[model samples]
Target: MFKILDKQELAESIIEYTIEARDIARHHHAGQFCIIRVHSHCERIPLSIAETNSQAGTITLVVQIAGHSTQELAQLEAGDSILDVVGPLGQPTKIGSPRRGIFVGGGVGVPAGSSMVRQMKQAGAQVLAIIGFRSKDLIIYEEKMRAVADELVVTTDDGSYGYHGLVTEPLQERLAAGEKYDVVITVGPVVMMRAVAEVTRPYGTHTIASLNPIMVDGTGMCGACRVTVGGETKFACVDGPEFDAHQVDFAELAQRLEIYRDEELRAHEAGPHECRLEQALKELG
Candidate 1:
């Protein structure tokens, strides 16, 4: 059992979790993820490692309460022991030392991207980070991202703060303005990554993106996380959690992600699931 050391709600549907897991934290790296199981019977869910403190025996997870498993995770509090925590799984990201490297993240992906930005800085690369959220109130990890980044850009969809637009807009402006970067990395929804790829395509900038396609066991056994990259099928859990954004088939990915939605919807509507929608509607009545 891994103990929950700290858990805080950072924004709407977003949270920061510090958990105690000695083995995993000791060797965890950026672009890796851990499989979290709420209980003995619950299915495993994979979450990116935002940060890890080996000496403290703690690993941090930044997550959005997206579905049943994540919602259950939000219910856990400090001092609670999760049923199981297994990882440092997936191939770690490999970045070259460059004059400047830009990392882009949207919404919950910001925290994970922040982890790489820090490591890249440590490795002697000047890092410029672009982090985006729906609004100012939803932004997270700015202080942390700023700590390592030589330059940081924060953007929002609703223009509540920072650049007052999508991260890609500023990305294009910077690239177009001749702000050259050896490499660009983005971690976010498929649509966001697709857009980033489009922006960087003409520039021929090598772009890396973290892919979180549907994962079940978060292991090679399940084969649920296989994704086509460079015309070959690879597993996200073991082969990668990051791939060249240019090579990823985002259309297939976006489609496959919805393949299980119907069953998920049925599961939610079938009852026996705790849901906010039910409570909210009752309160309204």
Candidate 2:
């Protein structure tokens, strides 16, 4: 069992957990994620490793309480043991000697891409990070991203704070202003990533997008995480969670993301599901 060493609420419904996963912490790289099971019989969910401390043998996971599984995870507290914490999975982001790079993230995606942004800066590349949220209240990881990036721009769709626009606006403005970047990496809602891709396509900027698909198993054995990149089938679990943005079929990806929408709604309406242990403890009490 992996112990939850610490926990913090980053934003409304967003929780960050520092887990004691020794080997995973030591081997983890930017862009890799972990599949966590809160308790036996609970469905597993994929979460990005926002940060890691190899010496401390811990990895950080930022989880947004979206559905049943994530809600169950949020119920866990520090010192609780997770039933399963399997990972260091997925390919690491390729930061191949870029002179300048732009990292775009939104909502929970901000923390998701924090490690990648930090790594890029450490590699001697000038990094500009653009992070967005629905409103000021939903913002997270501002200082974390700012500390590692050369420049940080925060946007909010409702004009509640920062740039008061979508993340793509700043990106488009920069590119249009003759600002050049060796690479642009985006992680967020599908529509946002697609928009960012379109903004950079005309400039021929090398853009990569991290994909979130329905994944089960996380080891490539379960074909659930398959996505279309450049018309070829690729599994996000093994082939990549990050792919060339221009070549990705965003329409198909957006459609696929809705596959379990109805079921999730029903599950949510039924209320949070507890594992057998929780029920047993309640019964005994």
Candidate 3:
């Protein structure tokens, strides 16, 4: 059991947990993720490693309470133990001395991009970050991203803060203004990453995307996280959670993610049984 050393609410329905996993924390690099099981009966879920401290023997995971498993995980507090925490899985991002690089993130993807930006800066690259959210209340990791990036642009769809537009807007404008980038990295919803790829493709910029598909086992045995890249089959679990943006078949991946929608809805509707049943029994009494 891995103990929850710390927990912080980053935003509404979004929380960050620091877990005691010394071995994984010590070896994890940027762009790798961990598979966690809230309990023995719960399905395993994959989450990006937001930050790590080897000395502290902890790794930070930022989670959005999207479905049943994540909502249950969020209920855990400091000192609570997680049943299974398997990790340092998938290929780490390849950091090199690119002259200039752009990192783009949306919603919860911001935390996933944070460590990557730091690694890029450490490798002597001029990193620029563009992050998007629905509104000000949904934004997270702004200061963290700003600290590592040479330049940071925050955008909101509702005009609540920073620039009032999608993250792709500034990126498109920058490329239109003749700004050059050696590489572009993005992490977000499938549609958002697709948009980023479209924007960067014409400029001949190399783009990398961190994909979050429906994954069962963190290892390659399950075949649940299979995706098509360059017209070939690849498993996101072992081969990558990261891939070339140009080669990913986004439409197929998007469809596959919805395969469990009905089951997910049923789980959410059921909610936490103990709380639900206890409240109902009290009201009846």
Candidate 4:
């Protein structure tokens, strides 16, 4: 059983949990994720490892209560025990000798990118991070990203905060300014990552996007997370939650996110135990 050590409300419906998972945190690294199960009957869900401290034996998970499992997970308070917590799964980000790097994170991707930014900075890379949201009320972790990154740009579609546009704006400006980045990592909404790929295409920048598809199992066997990268199929779980953004098929990914659309909606309306983010947002409304 994983013990909940702390809980925080980041946004209206978003909750961050710090769990005492000694074994999991001890082996966790930046960019790794975990598959959480609320109980024996709960559906498996993948969540990013927002932060971890091996010495403290804790792992932090920032989750927007979107579905059933996540909604249930949110109601859990400190000292509550989770039925199962299975990870530090998938490969960790490779921040080799960080040249100049740009980290782009949108919405929930903000927290995930926060850890990666800190990790890359700790490795001696000058980090420039961009975080975006629909509006000011939805934004999170800008200051956290700024603390580690050398430069941080915040954007919102409605001009509610920071720049009034997508994260791609400043990214292009950097490119125009003759910045040569060793890597461009983006994690966010499907459309946002796709847009990132489009803008960086001509520049030949290596853009890595953290792929969040319909993953049944956090292993290669399920083949549920399979995606075409450079015309070849790869699983987002075992192969990557991160991939070459340039070669990724964003159209196919968008379709996959809708594959279970009806069922997901049905599940959402059924109860808070259906999906984490959606359910929580509904409850907030």
TM-score of 4: 0.92
Candidate 2 lDDT over residue span 112-187, tens digit each: 7889998888788999999999999999999998888999999999999999899999999999999999999999
Q: 165-258 in candidate 1: lDDT tens per residue? A: 9999999999999988888989988899999999999999999999988666677876778888988898998989999989998888888777
Error of 2 at 23 (Å): 0.5
How well is each residue in 3-92 modelled by candidate 4, as lDDT tens digits? Answer: 989988988888888998999889987788998887666667788988888999999888888765667677789889888888888888
| Candidate that scores best on lDDT | 3
Candidate 4 steric clashes: 12
RMSD in angstroms, all models? 5.7, 5.4, 6.1, 4.8
At residue 14, what lDDT does model 1 achieve? 90
Residue 273 error for model 2, in Å? 5.8
Model 3 clashing residue pairs (backbone):
none
Candidate 1, residue 109: how far the Cα is off, in Å = 0.4
Off by over 4 Å in 2: 270-285
Q: Which ten residues in a row have the lowest lDDT in candidate 3?
A: 273-282
TM-score of each: 0.93, 0.94, 0.94, 0.92
Instruction: Give the lDDT of residue 236 in candidate 3.
Output: 96
TM-score for predicted model 2 compared with the true structure: 0.94
Regions more than 4 Å wrong, model 4: 270-285
Question: Which should have the higher TM-score, number 2 or number 4?
Answer: 2
Compared with the true structure, all predictions reach lDDT values of 0.84, 0.88, 0.90, 0.83
lDDT of 3 by residue, 1-285 (tens): 999999999999999999999999999999999999888777677999999999999999999998877888988999999999999999999856888999999988999898999888888889999999999999999999998899999999999999999999999999999999998999999999999999999999999999998777779986778999999999999999999999999999998777555557766788654333223323434
